[model samples]
Target: MAFRGSLFKFLVVITLYDAFLTVNSQAETTDPTKMTAAILVRVDQSGKGDYTKIQDAIDAVPSNNTELVFVLIKPGIYKEKVTVPADKPFITVSGTKVAETIITWNDSENIFECATFTVLASDFVARYLTIQNTYGNGAQAVALRVSGDRAAFIGCRIISYQDTLLDDTGRHYYSNCYIEGATDFICGNAASVFEKCHLHSVSEGAGAITAQRRESPAEDTGFTFLGCTITGVKTAVLGRPWGPYSRVVFAFSYISSAILPQGWDDWGDSSKQSTVYYGQYKCYGRGAITSKRVGWARSLTSQEASPFLTKDFIGAKDWIRPAPTSFRTASKPISHHSDGNN
Candidate 1:
């Protein structure tokens, strides 16, 4: 009977694995955009791998159903406009090195269409490039806007004064990246996760995280910080409830002295303080003390620390791998930065 039970468990595991693969295979599937622009498109039609501009390669590939266009962006500062439409899926933009490749746009509050790169498509992946809205401490400037259904950022750096990451819709993932912002800069209403990344606050007075305008339970408009570091010079709360049902969690993360003892603010909306789900689990540091934490804030128990807080939490078990590497930590680590960047 023991042997029979063991065999049954093995079969069940196999069945579950197969089911997962099947589900992932169909999730947003792909689009059919190919990179037919040789291996390089030289300004003077020069030699291989030396394109005239990155935009040339981007323009060569046309968006279609099941688009799988891979553009190997060479190292250099690319200053231009990038618009990924809704039907363009599987647009894997990989740079040679994180430090070597940069895409910059200077659009301030007054500048219309102020987005460096806008992703309205689904299942798009970007790696090793620094995307910045070099609007210089202005308002309504967005560095990267993810309006797509499923988007991923790996080994990248996003810098801006305000609205750095505009998560307009769908599920998104950020791993091994650096994101710095001010005010309600990192605001959005999407199911998103920042895994093994760095979140920095630039201004003396600005919020680190924000879940703007999420009034629905079905829309997972929450930000899950998994094994990330939150540090700044000024006193920073975890976040204010931008919407009524706004949700966020810092699981297995590190908090610095820059955070206040209370850890959160009401944003002048007392009713939102009750409905929003804000919590922390297994975080350590000077600001980890929940003794003075807000009444609405939560410290999760071990049982509640399962899929919702683990690597599988926030749906990270979905499509987020490569570039930044997968989340392979058996347990959370203490927060300590070598460069004092944290």
Candidate 2:
């Protein structure tokens, strides 16, 4: 009878151990965020991932989301127009490889209506992807339109013919990006900083790289390119004034021979030549020669270029963050529709 009691006690201990294991396994599977700590969803062309469409994956994220949702897209050609709504903030759409993962469209109607990927949400991030509008040269086709404040792009390739990057309105940051276009490619009034980026102009004739539209002097809107490289197929000007008070600065950048000697254009309105603030500082290469630059454009001094040199120009220190490494699975799916406007 004593031996029987010992066996019974051993069986009880074994049962308790199995129950503890079951509860722990359920916790890890049900709420992985407790261990990994980020909301993650995956989009794949194959049936392996959670969603087949990228838009569907984005739709799964809740509106007015305060936490970061990391959407991992598998390598494939996504031929859909994607828009991040204004209510959904703190989202990151990342790709494994820029060359393989492409988001492309052939919309050539209007600049406002034709972007392949539009980011209308603040505190958004895009990484290692190519966003292109294949509307070659006739109309104003925008590959990417960023209208949200504090949007950031890393290792992205933005390509189009005219108005490639409609940096519409925001405090944006592009790092290690490749932006290519022909006319007014990088246009907008966003106070942006392009760091270590490559701007390639595919113009066959005369084209302007930027058309900054800062309407008033009071508006703190401008474009600042630092440690960037500019190349082109044919001659192009550094920028033309899309607004009377438009401002642009290129500092510590490499300007290729494709740039026109005048450096800037008045956009046929000579009045803009005086109001537009076009400046260059410590830039090297054949196109950066200031001797033939327009009289209106300035050769900035060290003191003048100080304000535009760092991420501080856009107050990036407060909002900009690194790509997250850990992740949690997505929860509570939501629905949304795109009307082309945010």
Candidate 3:
């Protein structure tokens, strides 16, 4: 009996040692260029990963996936028209940094066809990347067009000249992002919150920051700017009514001198002046002049401005909870530029 026990113990020890060796080998042999994550696809321009193109990595994911599929993109300028299809949900595309990992194309005025990067999938999250339209200051070019629900863009730089960002539909969140354009740079009917972001106007002449298209007051579509900075070269207005009931609010934000004294426009429609809801609550800086603001524009009181200052406006708790909060409340109107990255 003692001899039999000794033999069994020796075999168990040998088995464990072999298993350790196998696991170690697998770890050591993992591709150095590949990033470790819940990554379903790895993209490397150097041809060391699963795919070389961002679109290929996106296509590799199965359709209608409920679980999040991460696409680890290496640092490089991917010059392709990348689109995240509507069928693919819970997709995350991430890179090392916004300046390092760029997805670019030059398409203009054709909406989706001209967009450099378009996301039609819901529950989409993108971080540490730059999306640009290189066509540069001619026609209506869109750098990034997002028509996805529960979509979040963090630490992203979207650069273009005209019609820069189409926040087309659904509820979206943009935090610590840099968006630049000349005309109607941020237009669409989406209920989006620009939190701690920098909005730049590159138009040599006058331009408009936003052109919200809310057809009805019942529709939950508007642009809310909280603790953000609006800086650019041209003299600009806050927004124009793309639709009759268009709504936009800039609360606790820094509006540079570039902003026109009129603050808001009626898009050349005199009747729209009575229907649009354009308001500013406790905003600051040289261009945040309220007394000279357009007669149609409103300076919201505390009670009227409360709802537009929180994540609950987008009902973010239902989908992506804990949207980035603002240190600058309506009462203080301070500039909170730091969202996370320092």
Candidate 4:
């Protein structure tokens, strides 16, 4: 009986130990810290980072990547055109400073091919970078083309002449960024929210700020600017219809004197004036005066403006997040220019 009792005690201890091991294994597997640790790579123009070119660092990330890969670009003007392919998701290409880190190109030929920086991957983020197409004042040159879904831009400066930001096809969010262009600058079919951003028009004549391309009422796509500031070198209209059923909204924003009194345009097609949905709600400034605005535009009521005023317009809360604070170095640090200087 004493021997049987001792064996029973030993078996209980073994069972508890096994259960403890299983629990610990499950805990480790489900740890958020381990799951969210980003893979870090650096890019420097002066050969001081993991890769000399921005594209090379991007290429190093494996296709269909599930982990967050942070591509830290050192300050300098990268003249090469860069594209983040669709397969490489969960990538953050960030610069230390906005003014010092520039990705520039001088392609003026085709609107489809001339973007300086293009994001084709979903779950992509670009922060504190100046993306510019140096084609001034004539052609359809695009500075930054974001065709990826769930992409976010924070504190970025996008510059060009026409079609500066092809906010293309995506559900996107732009926060505290500066977008500058002349004609039909911020145009596309994306459902996007620009919050606290500065839309500066460098138009010499009457240019349009946005050219939304929502073709049908069923399509959930439009451009909403909330708490944004609009300024320009010369007179510009708020937006025009790039598609028959285009939609755009500006709410609680500052519209500078650079805006035309006749707020919206129909893009030379009078028929578009009947179908496009352009509205402004509780906006202030000399440009926000709606008394002289086009008959088609609406002075939206509070209830009507409610939809465009929140991050829910782009459904950003589901995917939008800052780059992870913890990261594992993906490559050896090479000698690179650390000072963020132009």
TM-score of each: 0.77, 0.86, 0.82, 0.87
Prediction 3 TM-score vs. true:
0.82
Quality of model 2 by C-alpha lDDT: 0.85
Q: Mind giving the per-residue lDDT tens digits that candidate 2 earns over 117-211?
A: 99998888999999999989789999999999989999999999999999999899999999999999999999999999999999998999999
Q: Distance from true position, residue 310, model 3, in Å?
A: 0.5
Q: On residues 214-312, what C-alpha lDDT tens digit does candidate 4 reach at each position?
A: 999899999999999999998999999998999999999999999999999887899988889999999999999999999999999989889888989
Candidate 3: worst-modelled 10 consecutive residues by lDDT: 327-336
Candidates by TM-score, descending order: 4, 2, 3, 1
Worst 10 contiguous positions by lDDT, candidate 4: 19-28
- How far residue 264's Cα lies from its native spot in candidate 4, in Å, is 0.6
TM-score attained by model 2: 0.86
The TM-score obtained by model 4 is 0.87
Any residue pairs clashing in model 3, and if so which?
none
Give residue 318's lDDT in candidate 2 (0 to 100): 73
Model 4 steric clash total:
2
Lowest lDDT 10-mer window, candidate 2?
A: 19-28
lDDT of 3 by residue, 241-271 (tens): 8889999999999999999888887778999
